[model samples]
Target: MLKGITENAVQSLIASENPSDIQFDIVVIESNKKQEEYAYPCTRTLFPRKKFGFHKYFNLGISKTDSQYICLANNDLVFHKSWASEMLRAFDADPSLVSASPACSIHHPAHGVDLYSGIHEGFEVRKEVAGWCLFFKREMLDITGKLDEGFTFWYSDNDYINTIQKHGLKHALVSSSIVDHLESQTLKSKDEKEQFKLTHNDRFYYEYKWGKRSLFSYLNIKRKLFFR
Candidate 1:
């Protein structure tokens, strides 16, 4: 499968796996791009028929699917052969595990959550996983509820971690469930200045929703954001 979330990624997902119970509900935020039909029996939605922030799409997708296990994945990912099986096994092995994300050795530095590091393989409990792909049981919604759609583009992952922690839930990174994330591969509809402004604005909202970060901490994140 293609490594980045794109139209071809859906086709690749279908091509990689054998006939199974898995289903896809493709949600496009804006309808400016051309749409095509997939061979699989799936639903498609052009939400708001316009561009919006990330969490809104995910919330809408969850509402549209009734699967017991839902994987909120970005379109740009290359699913290794065992990705699905390993993720499911982690949940099966730990009934208390409420959420998970497949591991990527090359990580984009995440702030505000303690995570397991230096593992080439195996499952490890974590405070959070990168937001690129988050998998969890449907019932988790009962406790954590839908992702806070207020996170227009950033810090929703941190908010989710806070939610999981508040509810005494465990989030894990399943190393064997490998999915290569194409980081920042999604097309940016906004210009650089506007994107930067929106990101900082989101950070302020994050602090307001959670708690304040020190000046140094905010500066550190700013440096990484600029360089990354």
Candidate 2:
């Protein structure tokens, strides 16, 4: 977490209206070994992990705790006071819900979802929630297993939903809970040229595992890559 991004995010949760009985824990899977510390609420553990891959860190983080409810959140999110309470209420109301994501109006436009725009009150069932923040029951891990570590960075979310749905699990977008996504903060730190290369690498791997998105989707990348 560059700057005080992770600290700010954690403190925001401490300032929020959390569930009374729920013991909020934080497991920091650091992208680099900066060894920064924060005065966060509840139990906290910091794991210095310089390696990349979304699932690799997430799976490791989850293993660090035994909380019934697990949330995989990005470092750049500023959570609203109502976010935690509202998200838990949704899970309590629907036992069938395996995973849910909070709505974030402050997310970057490139994130592809204008959270508050065209969104309605309460929960909206869907095949997938936004990748920035994912909240789910720990039992979900038992069913879907660890997300495919094969996904280097991108497409882990896509693969997660595919496995989730195949197991008859459902996910929802919790509009009542809101947060801010300083979208792709880590990716933004990298040069644009490198970003494209990494994204294409993930895309190629995704297609290799799941087949082409569609016949035409293959043409979206370089023709040389497509033929190769």
Model 1: residues with Cα > 4 Å off, grouped in runs: 1-5, 21-43, 105-128, 187-189, 213-228
How does each model score on lDDT?
0.65, 0.71
Q: Among these predicted structures, which one has the highest TM-score? A: 2
Worst 10 residues of 2 by lDDT: 119-128
Global lDDT for candidate 1? 0.65
Each candidate's clash count? 3, 0
Model 2 whole-model lDDT (C-alpha atoms): 0.71
Per-residue lDDT over 1-228 for candidate 1, one digit per residue giving the tens place of the 0 to 100 score = 222246555565555445564444555344234445333224364535446667877787778778888887777776666567777887888898878887654552343222234222213223237577788899999988888987877776777777888888888777666666676554365578767865785787678667686656766676766675
Candidate 1, poorest ten consecutive residues by summed lDDT: 118-127
Clashing pairs in 1: 4-76, 5-75, 5-76
